[model samples]
Target: MLSICKIYFMLFLYLSINLFIMALYFILLNMEVFIEYNLLSFNSLSMVMIVFIDWMTLFFMSFVLFIAALVTKYSEDYMGLDKSLNRFILLVVLFVLSMMFLIMSPNLISILLGWDGLGLVSYILVIYYQNIKSYNAGMLTALSNRVGDAALLIAIALMMNFESWNFIFYLDFFKNDDMMKIIMFFVILAAMTKSAQIPFSSWLPAAMAAPTPVSSLVHSSTLVTAGVYLLIRFSSAFSPMFMDFLLFISLFTMFMAGLGANFEFDLKKIIALSTLSQLGLMISILSLGNSDLAFFHLLTHALFKALLFMCAGMIIHSLNNCQDIRFMGGLSLYMPITCTLFNICNLSLCGLPFLSGFYSKDLVVEIMSMGYLNLFVYLIFYLSVGLTVCYSFRVVYYTFTGDSNILVLSTLNENSKIMLSSMIGLVFLVVFMGSILSWVMFPFPYFICLSFVMKMMTCFFILMGIFLGYECAKFSLEYSIKAVLFYNFSMFSASMWNMPFLSTFGVNYYPLFLGKIYMKNFDQGWLEYYGGKNLYNSLKMSSSSFQLFSRNHIKIYLLFIILWLMFMVSFLII
Candidate 1:
C-alpha cells in the first residue's frame, strides 16, 4: 500500500505529464484558452476571475508540478523522521497549488491571491524548525515578500482605469500610455522583490534557514521564478527607460551574487546565492528585450537547480544537518551517486557544453555579444559569468575534492533509495531539458556572428575562473595569512556586501529610532501632557474645588453676609 507522501507524489507526477502534453498541443496548434467568470459588474466595469492558458503557462506549470512531485518524493526520506511530516507535506502541496494559480492568472487580483499565498506558505516553511534563526529568517522572508504584495495591490488598483483586470489583453494596447507605464513599473517592482533582485536579494540567502526540501522547492521553480514569469507575461509593456533601469540593477545583482558566493562558506547559502545570480541573469536578459531567452533559461535553471538542492539535501541529511562546505570534503569518495549528481548540476550551472545550462546560458551570452550594449555591460556580464564558474568550482573543490574534514566515524553514503530515486529522476531532465526546451521554444535558429576574440571571451574567462577557484581553495600558511590580511573585504563579500544587514538592520534602525523618539516626545510625553493626562488633571482639580464649595456652602454664605453687615454699620456710624 502507498503512503500519503507516495500518493501525493504520484498524483503530482500524473498531473505534470498531462500538463506537458497539453502544453505541447497548445504550442503546436498556436492556441490559447481563456476561461473567465464574471463575479460582479457595475457601470461598464466588470470584476472577473480569469485563467489564461497558453503554451508558456502550461509549460511552466508542468515543470513546476514535475519538480514538486520529485521534491515530495524526496522529502519522504529526507524528512521521514520528523514528527510533523504530514504538515510539511501539506504545506508543500499548498505551495505548488499557489504556484499553479500564479502561473494561470492574468488578472492582478487573482495573482495577488497566489502571490500572498506563496509568501505566507513560504514563511511557515522557513520557520518549520521552530528556532530563533528560522524565526528571524521567516520574518525577513515574509516582510520582503510583503513589499511585492503591496506593489501588486497598487498595480491592481491602477489597472482600474482600463475597466478590466485582465492585464494580458491590455499590455500591448496600452504599452505606450503613461498609466500603463506606471502599472508596469509597479509590476516590475513586484517582480524585483519576488525574484530577490538587488536590494531585495538578502532574503533569498537568509531563507536557507528553512528545511532543505522546502529550500529546493522555494528556490528552484516556485517562489523566486514567479517574478520572472510575470515579467515574461507582461514583457510587451516595458518601456526603454524601465528596461535600461532593470538592466543595470539586474547586472549588478548578477555580479554581486556570484562574487558573494565565492566568499560564502555555508553550502546551502552558496547555492542560494547562485540561484540569485541566475535570477539576475534572467531579468537582465529580459530587460534586453529577450523575454523568451529569459523564460528558456528559467526553465533550464529550474531543472538543474532542483536536482542540485536535492543532492545537497542528501549530503546535509547524511552529515546530520551540517551545511558548511569547509567541513564537507571527500564526499565523492563515500557518496558517489550524490556527489556525481551534485558536480553535474554544478557543471551545468557553469554552462558547460552539451549540458542543460549550456543550451540556454551559452546562447544568452552569445546573443548578448550581438547586442548594442555598452562596454560596461559587456565587461560586467562576462565577469559575472566568470565569477559563476569560480564559485561553482570553489564549491566543488571545497565540498568534494579537498581532504576529508568530516569525522572518521561519520558514516556517509547514498543509502536512502527514496531520495536517490527522486534525484535520479531530475538528473535526466537536468541533462536533457535544455536542449528539448530550446528546440521547442525556438522553431527558428538564432543568427549569430562574432569576431574570434569575442567568441572566445566566454571560454577564456571560464578557464581563468577555474584557475582562480583552484588557487582560492588551496590551503597554505601564506594563503591563510593573506586571507587574514584581507579579512574586512572577505567579510563584506561573504555577507553579500552587507546586504543582510542593510535589508534588516540598516532599513529598520532609523525608523525604529524615530519611533522611539516619537514615543518619548509625543505619545508618552507631550501628548500625555497636553491631551489625556493634562485634561484629567484639570478635571480633577475643578472637581475638588467644587466639592469643597459644595461641602462648605452654608458657612461660606454666613461669613459673606456678616462681612457685608459690618461694612454697612461702619458706613452709618461715619
Candidate 2:
C-alpha cells in the first residue's frame, strides 16, 4: 500500500515537472502571462488575486519543483517504515504547494497569504517529531516567523494608502515617494526576520531539530529564500538609506554566521550556520544595488546547498543517527560516492572557479570591490569570504580525511539507491547551474575594469583561508593556543556572542513576564470582576428585587397605580 502511494506521488510530481517545463518554453520565447481577478469589493476597495509569470517565475518554479520531486522520492527510503509516513509525505506536499503560491503571486494580499502559509506549514513540519527539542525549535521557528508575518501585514496595510493591494503596479510610481519609504521599512524588517538576519538568526540553527529533508528544503530554497525573492521584487523602490541599513545588517549577519560555523561542533548546526552565511551574502549583494546578482546567487546556492544537506543526511543515517563530526572520520573509505558529493558541494560553497557558486559569487565580489565602500565594509566582506573558505576546508578535513574516530565500525555504506538518486540529480545542477544561469539570464557579461592588486586579493584570500584551515586541522592533537590564551573570547565565538542564549532566555524573559502581568491584572482581575463577578452580582440583585415586588402582591400594585394618577393630576393643575 505504501509503495503504491509513493508511486502515485512521484507520478504527480513528474506531471508538475512537465507543466513547469512547458511554462519555461513560453518564458524562453519571451512570452509573459499575467492574470488577475477581483474576488470581492467593499467601499471602493477590491480583494484581488494576481498571478505573474515571467522568465524568473518559470525558472524558479522549475528548480523548486525539480528539487521537491527529488526530496519526496528521497524521503521514502530515508524515513524508513515510520508509522507517520503518510503524514510526512502530506506535509512535504503541502509545503511545496505553499511555496508555489508564494512564487506565483505579485499582490501584497496574495504574498501575505503565501507567506503565512509557509510559516504555519514549516512550524508543523519542524515539530513533526513531537519531542521536546522539536517542540521548542518549532515554537522558536514559528515565533520568529510571526514577526515577519506581522511585518508583512503592516506592509500590506501601508499599501492600502495607494488604493491597490497589488504591489507590482506601484513599483515604478512610488520610486521616490515618502510613503513608499515607510512601506519599505516594514518590508526590510519582514525580510530580516525571514532571512534570519542577526538577532532573529538564532532560530535557524535551532531548527535543525527537524528532519534532514526538511532542513534541505527549508534552508536551501523555500523558507529562507522567500525574503531574498521579496527583496528582489521590490529592489527598484529601495531608497539609499534603506540600502545602507540593509548592507550593515547583512554584513554583520554574514560575519557572525561564518564565525559561528567555525566553532560549531554539531554537524547539522554547522551546515545551518553556513546557510545563514550564504543568506547574508545574498542580502548584502542585494543591498549593493544588484538584485540580479543576488537572485543568481540564490539560485546557484540552492542547487549546491540542497545537495550538501542530502549528503549530510546520508552520512547521519549511515552512522546510526550520530551527527558529531568528531565521531565521523575516514568516510571516504566506506562511502566514496557520498564523500565525493560532499566534497563537490563544499568546494562549490567556497566558490571554486567554474562551479555553480563561482559564477555568481565571484561576480558579486568584484562588483562590490568596484563600488566605493568604506574600509570597514570592504574588510568585513573579504574576511567573511575567507572565513567561508576556511570552514569549508575544515569540514572537508574532519569528515573525510582523518583516521577512523569511532570505537567500533558500523556498516557504513550508501546502498540505498533512492537517497543516492536524489543527490545525483542535484549534483549535475551543482556543477553546471552557474554557467546555465549566466547564459540564460544575462545578455551581456559583467565587464569590470579593476587593478591587478584588487583582483589578486580574492585569490589571496582563498589561499590564506586554505592555509589557515589546514593549520587548524593539522594541530587537532595539540592544545589550541587561542583557546588556552583567550578562554572567554573563545567561548564567545563558540556561543556566537551568546546570541542563542540572548535570543532564547533574553527574548523569553520579557514576554513571559508581560504575559504574567496581563494574566494577573486583566485576565484574572478586572475581567473577572467586571465581566463575570459583577454581572453575576447584578443579575442576582435584580432577581432579589423581583422577588420582593412579587411578595408585596395586588394591594401594593393598586396603591402604586393610585399614587401615579394623583401625581399626574397634580402636574396638570400646576
Candidate 3:
C-alpha cells in the first residue's frame, strides 16, 4: 500500500508538471489569471484572498513540484526501512502543498498561512530524527523563523493603513508614506530571515540535521528561496536605501558563506554553506534592481543544489553515515556514477560554461560589473564567485580523487537504482535548464559591454579558484608553518565565524541572565513580599485581631453594630 501510494504521488506530480507547462505556454501568450475571494470582513479591514498566476508562477511551481516528486520517490528507498516512513512521506507532501500555497498567494494574510506553514512543517522535519543535535537544530530553525514570522505580522499590521490587505494591489501605494516605508523595511527583514541572510544564516547549516531529501527540498528549492521569491514579488516597493542595505548584508553573507565552505569538512555542511552563498547571490542580485536575474539564478541553483544534496546523501548512505570529506577519496574508482553526478553538480555550482548555473551566474556577474558599485562590494561579489569554485573543486578533489579512504572490504557503488533514477530525472534538467529557461524567459540577451579585464574576470577567477582550492585542500594541514600561523583563522572560518555559538549561547546569554534576574528579583523578591508574603502576613494579622475582638465579648459586637447603624442613619439623614 505504501509503495502504491508513493508511485501514485509521483505519477500525479509528473502529470501536474505537464499540465503546468501547458498552462505556462498559455500564460506566456498573455492569458493570465487572477483569482480573488472575500472570506470575511471586520468594518474597514477585510479578509481577502488573492492569487495572481502568470507564466512565472506556473513555471516555478512546476519546477518545485518536479523536485518534490523526485525527492519523494527517492525517499521510497532512502527511508524505506524506517518505521516512520509513512510520517516522513506525509511531511514531504504537506511541505509541497505549503509551497504551492505560497506560490499562488499574493495576499499578505494568505501568504502568512503558507509562510507559517512552511516554518512549522520544516521545524517538524528538521527534528524528525529525535536526537539531541536534531532537537537543537530544530529549536534554532524554529526560533530564527519566528523572527521572520513576527516581521511579516508587523508588516501586515502596518498594511492595514492601506485599505486592502492584498499587497499585490498596492505595490506603489506605500512609496511616499513614512509609516509604509517602515512596514516595507520589516517586509525586507522577513525576507532576509527566510533566505538565511546574515544573522539568520546559522539556521541553514543547523537545519542539515534533517534528512538529505528534506535538505534538498528545503534548502534548495522551497524554504531558503522563500525569502528571495517574496522580495522578488515585492521588489517595486523597495526603496533605494533599503536596496543598498540589502546589498551590503547580502554581499557579506555571500562572502562569509563562500569562505566558510572552503574551511568546512563535513560533506553536507559544505553544500549547505554553498546553498547559503547562492542565496546571498540571489538576494543581492535582486537588491540590484533586477528580480528577473535573481529569479533566473534561483531556479537554476535549485536544479544543481538539489542534485548535489542527493548525491551527498548517496555517498553518506554508502559509507554508513560518514560525512567528513577527509575520510572520503578515490570514490570515482568504485562509485563511478555517484562521483560523476557529484562532479557535474559541483561544476554546475561553480558556474562552469553551459551548465544551468553558468547562464544565470555569469550574467549576474557581468550585470553587476556594469553597475555603479564601490571597490569593496565588487571585490566581495567576484571573490565570492571565486570562493564558490574553490570549494567546489576542493570537495571534488577530497572526495573523488587521491587514494582510497574507505574500508578495504566495503562494496560501495552507485547500486541504488531508486536514488539514481530520481537524480537522473534532475540531471538532464541541470544540464540544459539554463539555455531552455533563458530562451523562455528572455527574448534577447542582456547587453553587457565591459572592458577586457572585467569581461574575463570570471574565467580568471575560475582558474585561480581551481589553483587555490587544490593547494589549500591539498597542503593546508600538512605544512607546519601555514597550519600553525593560520590555525585560529581556519578554526573561525570552520566554525562559521562562531555563528552557531552566537545564535545559541551568544543570543541566549543576556536573555537568560535577564530571566534569572526576573526570577530572583520579581518572582521571589518584590512580588513575593508585596503580593504573596505580604498578603499572607496581612491576612494573619487580621485573623488574629478578629479572634481577640471576638474573645472580648458581646459588648464589642454591640458597639460595632451601633456604630454601623449610626453611620447608615447619618447618611440617610444627609
Candidate 4:
C-alpha cells in the first residue's frame, strides 16, 4: 500500500500534467469556459458558484499543482519520521485544492472562499512545529492576511451595486466609475496584504517558521502570488494614478526585501525575503500595465523558488535543523548535488543569463526602461535589481564557497534519494521553463530602442552586485567589528525597517494603552461610580427613607386628627 505522502504525490503530479495539457489546448484554441451554478436568487441578486476557465487560470493551476507534487514528494523524506505525516500530507492537499479554487474563480465570493482557505491553512502550516516562535509567526501571518480578507470582503460588498458578483465581466466596463474605483482600491489593498508589500511585509519572513515544504509552496505560487494574480485579473481596471501609486509601493517593497535579505543570516528567511522581493517585481511590472510580463515572471519564479526551498530543506535536514548561514560553509565539498542545485537556483534568482528568471526579469527591466516614468522611479528600479543580485551572491558565498563553519564531527551528504529526485525533477524547468514560456506567451518580440549605456545598465548592476556580495561575505579580523560601528542602521535594515515591530507591538501598543485607560477611568472609575455602584447606593438610600416614612405615617396621621379636632372645638367656642 502506498503511504499517504506517496498517494498525494502521485495524485498531484497526475493533476498537474493534465492541467498543463489543458492549458496548452486552451491557449492554442483561444478558448475560455465559464460554468455557473445558481445557488439562490433574491430580488435581482444571485448567489452563484462560478468557475471561469481560461488559459491563464489553467496555466497557473498547472504550475501550482506541479510545485505541490514535488513539495509533497520532497516532504515524504524530509518529514518521514514525524508521526503525523499523514495529517501534514492532508493539509498540503487541502492547500492545493484551495489554490485551484482561487485560480479558477472570477467571482469575488468564490475567490474569497479560496483566499480565506489559503490564509487559514497557511496559519495552521506555519504553527506546525508547535513552538512559541511558530505560534507567534502563525499569528502574525494570519492577522496580516486578515486585513486582505477584510478588503476583499468590502470589495465583494461594493460589487453588489452591479447585481453580479463576477468581477471579470465588470472590470473593463466600469473602469471610470467612482464606485468601481473604490472597489478596485479595496482590491489593491487586498493584494498588497496578501503579497506582503510594505506595511504588510512583516509576515513573509516570519512565516518561515513553517515546515520547509509548506514554505516552499506558500512563498512560491500560492499564498503570496494570489495577490499578484488578483491584480493581473483587475489590471485593466486601474487608472493611471492608481497604477503609479502601486508602482511606487511595489518598487519600495522590492528594494526593502532585497536590502533585508543581504543582512539576513537565517537560510529560510533569506529565501522568504527573496520571494517577497520577486512578488514586488511582479506587482511593479503589473502596475506598469504589463500583466502578461508579471504573470510570466510569476510562473517562472514559482518553478525555481520551490526548488530553492527544497534545497534549503535538504541542507537544514542534514545539518540537524541549523538554518543560520553564518554557521554553514563549504557545503559544496560534502553535498555536491544539493549545493550545485542550490547555486543554480540562486543564480537563476539573480536573473543570470539563460536561466528561468532571466527571461522574465530582464524583460521587465527592459520594459520599465521604455516607460515614460520619472528619474527617481528608474533609479530605484535599477537599484532594486542590483540588490537582488547582491543578496543572491551573498547567500552563495556564505553557504557554498566560504570555509566550513559547521562542526568537525557533523555528517553532511545528499543521500536522500526521494528528496533529491523531487529537486531534480524541478531543475530541468528552472533551466528551460523561462525560454519556453517566453516563446509561448509572446509570439512577437517587443521593440527595443535604447542607447547602449542604458541597455548595458542591468549588466553593470549585476557585476557591481557580485563584487559587493563577495566583499560582504569575506571575513577579516580588522573589519570583523565594523558592523558594530553602524549597529543601529544594520538593525534597522535587518529587522525589515522595523516593520514587524510596527505591525505588531507598534500597532497594538497605543490601542491597548487606550483600552487600559478606558478600563481604569470609565469601566472601573467614573462609570463604576455613576453607573452600577452609584445606582445601587441611590436605590438603597431611597428604600431606607421610604421605610422610615412608612413606619411614622400612622403616628403622623393620629397627630393630624387630634389637631383638627382641637381646631374645630376652638372655632365652635369662638
Off by over 4 Å in 4: 40-46, 475-480, 515-574
Write candidate 1's Cα lDDT for 452-479 as tens digits: 9999998999998898887776742136
lDDT of the structure predicted as candidate 4: 0.91
- lDDT digits (tens) for residues 512-540 of candidate 2: 99999999998899998999889999999
Q: What is each predicted model's overall lDDT from 0 to 1?
A: 0.91, 0.86, 0.88, 0.91
Relative to the true structure, candidate 2 reaches a TM of 0.91
* TM-scores of all candidate predictions against the true structure: 0.90, 0.91, 0.90, 0.90
Cα lDDT of model 4 by residue, 539-558, tens digit:
99999999988999998899
lDDT at 284 for candidate 4? 94
Score candidate 1 by TM-score against the native: 0.90
> lDDT tens digits, residues 158-206, model 3?
8888866778777886677798789889989899999999887889889
Q: Give one clash count per candidate, in the order shown.
A: 0, 0, 0, 0
Better of 1 and 2 by lDDT: 1
Residue pairs clashing in model 4 are none
Q: In candidate 2, list every pair of residues with a backbone clash.
A: none
After superposition, which runs of candidate 1 have C-alpha atoms over 4 Å from their true positions?
39-47, 475-478, 481-485, 517-574
Q: Which 10 consecutive positions of candidate 2 have the poorest summed lDDT?
A: 474-483
Q: What is the lDDT of residue 6 in candidate 2?
A: 64
